[model samples]
Target: MPEKTIPILPCRTLQPVLDFYTALGFEVTYQQRSPNPYAVVERGGIELQFFAMKQYEPAVSISTCYVLTDDVDGLYQAFRAGLKETYGRIPTRGLPRVGPLKDMTYGVRQFLVTDPGGNCVRVGQRTGGERHHGPAPQETFARALHFASLLADSKGDPAGAAKVVDRALALTDETPTRVQLLQLLVLRADAAARLGDEEAAVTGLARAAALHLTAAERDQGRDALTRLADLRGSLRP
Candidate 1:
């Protein structure tokens, strides 16, 4: 017989935890309500066990897990679609939002998704060296976007951010998803504006505006519109 270890995680309530996993394509294998709550969820060959704790505070909890997979981007897309389907819109900054896929310094391409119970499940694919070749082109672009974000927001280097995005843009062509193209353009515009390059900012905004957007994309661009307006105001003579 082989020994398999399944994590037993604590949750404030079992139902939300169940719902979260269910949305991510997991099925409830067993559940109990009376005499202390507990449940088991399984997806593919992975299994998770969750227990209810009335005093559990997810905000202070330090529960985390790593889900290694060969198709990290595909699973991430599925999870993103599931989250949006369940929550109407994916959360931008909180538990339940999926983080962008990144190539860690430790040499793995990974993304993080925090469950309702505040459990961080990192989906990763081993890369770098003969053990694995490299991530797909889309994954590389995703990693670049993540780096550009840190440069723009954390390091406060908009020029560096613009350069990172420019490198990604060079790698991409018309085959890239409209969402990716739009996001890259928006980020570039933001970086240009922060660099005091009004012409470049205006040009990037115009390019983004020319793209045919879906209803959801239009709604998502509202924030971009506000930023564009502010940039235009600053450029007025």
Candidate 2:
């Protein structure tokens, strides 16, 4: 089967966009550096890419992306549960309300979610579709790295966090997860700064800032830039 690619356009917050996908079980597959730095994530045969833009103003455009699955109902339940657990309310009750889980006329059972940036991520699995589920070999490593990074974050262990990131990089030749890499870099920056290696911290943050230098990434990278500056000021003698 031919691999499919989906485009993700975030108005200004690339980091949150990346976090949202990772939280939903997608794996980062590629990162581009030129002609614009973008990221590729894959779930099964479905691949999603981010098209970072300098300025993205919100609009009521119907940008839809399809996610393939073997259990549409189970997936929908998980999605609803996630929203409730994170926001303390059912996702169907308010703005960006969760749409119902129903079988479309086209033979796919799906539910829709409007991302914070206003993109619709449609999750679906075929009716009567048997669950042939497990992470791809590559995803297993990617998830491990992600989990370790989370653990490192909560435990204040930058060294351990860095190790996980290194493992993630090793799994894929190029992780188009610039935002995720930047985050890990930020963690490393904090870890380095705390451990008395101000130079390393600056270097990590600088690399992250440099990522935003592209036309598409300028605004996306600004948050990291501002954050780094704050760190720098705090570390000054």
TM-score of each: 0.57, 0.43
lDDT of each: 0.71, 0.57
* Top lDDT prediction, candidate number: 1
Task: Report how far off residue 123 is in candidate 1 (Å).
Answer: 0.8
Tell me the lDDT of model 2 at 200.
82
Q: Lowest lDDT 10-mer window, candidate 2?
A: 89-98
The clash count of every prediction, one per candidate, is 0, 2
**Candidate 2 has what TM-score?**
0.43
How do the residues 1-237 of candidate 1 rate in per-residue lDDT, one tens digit apiece? 799878888889999889988888889999999798999999886788999989988866678878788887678768767766776655433454455454554457676677778777778887765444344335765677667866864354789999998988887353446666766787788788667787888898788768897888766654444344434444455
Summing lDDT over every window of 10 consecutive residues in candidate 1, give the lowest-scoring window.
129-138
Q: All candidates: CA RMSD in angstroms? A: 10.2, 19.3
